[model samples]
Target: MNTDIAATLPGATKTHRDESFPVASRLIAPAHRAVVLAFYRYVRAADDIADAPGLAPEEKLRRLHAFEAALDAADPAVPLARALAEADRRHGCGAAQARLMLDAFRQDAVKPRYAGFAELIDYCTRSADPAGRFLLALHREDEAAQGPADALCTALQILNHLQDLVKDRERIGRVYVPEPWMALAGGEEAFFAPGNGPARRRVLDAVLDRVDTLLDTAEALPRSLRSRRLAAESVATIATGRLLARRLRREDPVTGRVDLAKADFARAFARAAPALAHLGFTSDAAVCRRIVAGSGSSFRLGMASLKGERRRAIHAVYAFCRLIDDVADAAAPAPERRAAIEDWRREIDRLAGAPLTPVGRELQAATRAFGLDPAEFHLLLDGMAADAAERVRIADAAGLDLYCRQVAGAVGALSIRIFGATQAHAFALSLGRTLQLVNILRDVDEDAAIERVYVPLDRLLEAGIPDGPATCMVQDPRFAAVCRALADEAEAGFAEADRLLAGLDRRALKPAILMMEGYRIVLGHMMRRGFERRGPRPRPNRRDRLRLVTLALRGQP
Candidate 1:
């Protein structure tokens, strides 16, 4: 409460009561509550000093160093630090974890902009992760809980950064939105301009997608905790994070303050209540199901009849493909995309060891259960790296085939094993390529929007179009000729898949047949519309979904 000391001023006196989400509250037991508060106060004081206006960066650094020294020496002059030191002695919440936050605050005193999402995430690991780790340590929760807790904490911090975007920029001259992201909106100036709402919203939504992925990983935190009270608290925190993320997505933070209402907390607590009794926790299967269902992919319809582990295995495969595909097509610089791909590569490599990501953990189990090959996943990543370029163009039919085999065909190879159809490799390869070709036809306009033309360069040239920008190639009259020829090849591929399907076990390959039928229907739609026509690709309607489900039930599709 002292105002004389630079780091002890009441100017930054916000408490747990003032936070957007709960800090240390009644949810924490009385035995642990005081120590949590002490930790919060120490960190909050350092954050305030770093954000203090009219103070030189050197002065902020000096004050922060003094706070760290106070903790080291148990100096009472810095009352919050002294309190935290005493609390640490009692609770064993490591000072090392608390110092990570001090380091982040010190970075904030000097660093005003983030280079990219990865850099921003690194910042979050220091600024936010330690808080969750502190609680985990205090409660003596399993070390495995730390990964999900870090995920939840980092998500909360990013959500806070997004909510405080305008305020942070206007008040402290700091901008947490990655600079590369701003570049995508035409530059930092245009990105922040009031008139740039639509562009800013697109960028913000991409950031929110990243947040959603983090929340998905954090979904395990509640179930990972052993202490009933902490489990309940974590469930509430995760619910609050998810609600706030959705709110941020719908409401533009740039236009005004977008945040949660008091009712939101009540709703989160209501959602968390079931967890206190150690019930209603979401499992890895549930997370995978959500991902697959949320995608609106036709494959979900095919997998509908499966139950138990088989269904979970299918969902796991589809979710892995969907997530990596997201990384490939993200609205980021190519280098950043490639870097993200590398991170995925590392995650895939960890499957045999201790994997940190939620999807990876689920995948490891699925692979082990199904005897799935891990090498196929690396193949998928290789294909994604090809697409994560500044511009994408297939050189020829062979090139196209290789790309499809790597991406879609590899998925088929994995899925068939999960389907228990071990001998369906030929069927899987044929249908995968056929479906990918249909995808290329449907996504010509959409892919061109991102400077990607999956139509082979040789085909384009033979159709009398030049090898130039993807957008221009799509507009050329000759483009339709190339598409028609590819459509014929796709039809043949489908026929080959059907022939191969007849030789395989129908019971085992039912899911593949259903998916092939769905894609065939889409192909028929495109053929009827003609390749010359240009517009949004037709999506399966409710009627289409019902028909597919019917076929699946009949064991015919």
Candidate 2:
């Protein structure tokens, strides 16, 4: 509706250019595309301004304030202002969610370090949870839906921050690891010391413990979403979050980058599907109570808000994902860790033969009910092993593709199974691949700084760029060429995602569309900037994001 705002913002072009909405293709129902696009554009735009480079500290503060003021005024001239207004007009989008985005940007500008886990949760409340809440509102879900949505969102935000700790600290000079834990490890100065040493390990262990606590909390939110469709989403998110958290806990924060393998994602999805489906039919209070009791502390606040069979199933799925992920990410040496993962994989395998533990029993029941395949579970373990092996440097587009398949695409395969998307598996896998590529592109700078390259080696060589993550982005002609090539590949992946969306169920379409569009927007930014030069990463401006949202609502697909 307001292209003027998109045109006016200095970063709007870059934001759109940098983002890669891999899932926002023709596969989506033309009806829902605009709304999905609009939401993503709004989020992207806000993020861009918050992360923009070359602005003085004062100027950054001023810009953030101006953005916040726009939210308050409902001015169409402001970037996200129109989207917020539209969400209100059409979907009853709350001012609180918009305000939360602004607050997160404010935090980005000011808060560089976290004091403790509580403070970290406060950040997630502002930054990550609001997006989930906004999406729930878009779906016209009631307070009951909103509560669980918030929990899942908050959990995801916490897990993401934990996973990116090393990269966040090294590239951004900001640390999300709690201050108290850092103190216990040997103080801030010691924690950041060059070289992987005992102090770093100690700090990481403390951080892992904190992560486990947060994950326990996150597992509690899915029970509130009574709708089978929404519960599936929540379960997938929880399973994914817990898996990542477990990796963060088990990995050597000094050397490895924590990421969910595609196979693992599929397994989580398969394991969570039946419970999610069951939620559609039952509203048993006892079931909800059992789930709440098992979820540990993360669900403590959320427990009182929900009651049903769906809640219990969600809790069981979350707990299982968290435990399995931890097993994969355990701090043991690679061989031992792989062995453990294999053992877990065997246990999952034997579920078809016989049940072992409560979690396993639950998973077996759910898998049977959902008609999930055992092979998907094995792929998850394989992906976890790949991650544990620290084998994810971006060497070329081919390598990147393989990595994406291992880390994210596999999840798509599993998700379709859980969603009963038998016919749409190919499309789902394509969308998943595109999303994974977008992630790699978005985190290029940060990933490089942490010595984990998801970029392909062949691409780098073709571009005549150095293979090392830190040096690849330097300003060289070949470096620029390589970046362009990679970006093009990402674009191609996005195209596939678009095709995939057209085949998915309508109820399951919007969220995937929004996520895809968000990533595509990021990839667009990367493409525009020649990807090689990275003083700061590019993202969408608020106005452009709003425009995208409007387009999504219009069903442009």
Candidate 3:
């Protein structure tokens, strides 16, 4: 530890958390603040070493590697290194991420010239990308978000680079200004030289154009998430990036310095309150209400009978469920798909009043309203994750049962709890299982097309149908038999759930009954139309829906 005290002092001294520069910001839960800060301390210390002009290149290299070594250590002797290790162990962070920042710092000590925009972006990959990646890990965001977060972080890095161009050239003899752009604008000498004011400004303007595009690319990132705290902070960061880009446009970057004023953030923060409300789970239950209405016809119809807190709670659950299904069904690459599902799991792990995604934040509010248990919420995630796989195999009835519990049964139980029914646990589970099984039967063709085989492998084999999505399977007579069998199971489940619901209060239970009946009617039509063949998918016709409303009027008739 005492190998070179004076040389490493700056990095060590700068190790304390910076109040002005939030590692994760106030929007992050206090419980997780330490994980965020631990990363910051390690990265900040390494960053200080790279920025240290007093330290020689070899010395910087020596100390930085020492920091890197601390990654795999159980307990690093260096304070910053210890924090890095602690964050890794505590939050399940990998040493690999800490190594990424160290690599960037190493580049900073030696490599100063960026030949092109792409090369500069590659630098940003290692330099700025790591921070967003680790932050997402802290927020428990999925891999789907990492791309956009990386884009945002890279833009910010470029902005900082542009803002410090003059100082870097004058003191360090470094040039991060892309080489090709420098030539296109004026020339290296004219752009970097202090006297050639007009030419240098032109080069800076060209650089600003590139930064502006990056900022534009990152615009939708905040909307894609549901966390209020992260939303508020991300919007603020986006606001600052936009503000800085404007400054680069207005001020002569070659002569004047660009600094973010507190007023700029104040103005943006005020604007963000409304933007965040739309993007975050607001107090008004708007996130739940809006997503439920827009998501699916079936959900809207089922939830129509619910009102007041009960309705809001169900909508919140519906909204949350809808997001998980969408993540599983998204046509992204496999890694991204898995990340999307894991993000849900992580958010649920640390769920509180404020979460990163707006839907999650709303669910938190809904949970508070109905006293919803997170354990059941977790079951919903497990179900979604199962669907996210390319080809989910159900070996037998047992597998299908677990899948149903994961996807719908858990949600059903949560809904019953929300609806003020304490004793109808079996009913809720049965209903969810019933609905999910019906959905599987109804979507057999559609699910097969998506390479999904929800019907157990044994059942498919028994039915003499192939196990994958193919034309032969579609035309096979056995496939129809499989559909019939599944439909029968769903029908049995429907009768059971209906019988169980009768034991609960019939007053507060109207909405629940209507929803169950809605499914029952759909199941009836599917069976009538011969579900095994290329029959039309069942939709509740106007008359059918009206009948449901009429039944509701008769007090669970």
Q: Which sequence of candidate numbers ranks them by lDDT, best first?
A: 1, 3, 2
Index of the highest-TM-score prediction: 1
Global fold similarity of model 2 (TM-score): 0.45
Q: Candidate 1: give the clashing pairs.
A: none
How many clashing pairs per prediction, in order? 0, 64, 7
Candidate 3 lDDT (Cα, whole model)? 0.72
Prediction 1 global C-alpha lDDT: 0.86
Q: Which regions of candidate 1 fall more than 4 Å away from where they truly are?
A: 1-10, 541-543, 555-557
In model 2, which runs have C-alpha deviations exceeding 4 angstroms? 1-33, 71-80, 144-148, 194-198, 271-276, 279-557
lDDT of each: 0.86, 0.58, 0.72
Tens digit of lDDT per residue, candidate 3, span 1-557?
Answer: 33343335473534333322234666566787777777777777788787787778788788787667655553335666767787777777735677897898998888878766667888899988888788777677777667667878888888878887877777666778776657644677766666776656655665564565455445556665666667666777777787888888787666777777778767666646755565432232664575577666565655776778777778878877876776677543334456667867887765674465545666777788888889998888888777777666688889999999988889877887777886888887888888988888777777766577787888888777656654456568777888788889888988887678666886666666777888888888888888555566788899998898787667445
**lDDT per residue (tens digit) for residues 356-424 in model 2:** 344555567657665656676666667667655533455455666666676566655654554445677
| TM-score of each predicted structure versus truth | 0.96, 0.45, 0.54
Displacement of residue 178 (Cα, Å) in model 2 is 2.4
Candidate number with the higher TM-score (2 or 3): 3
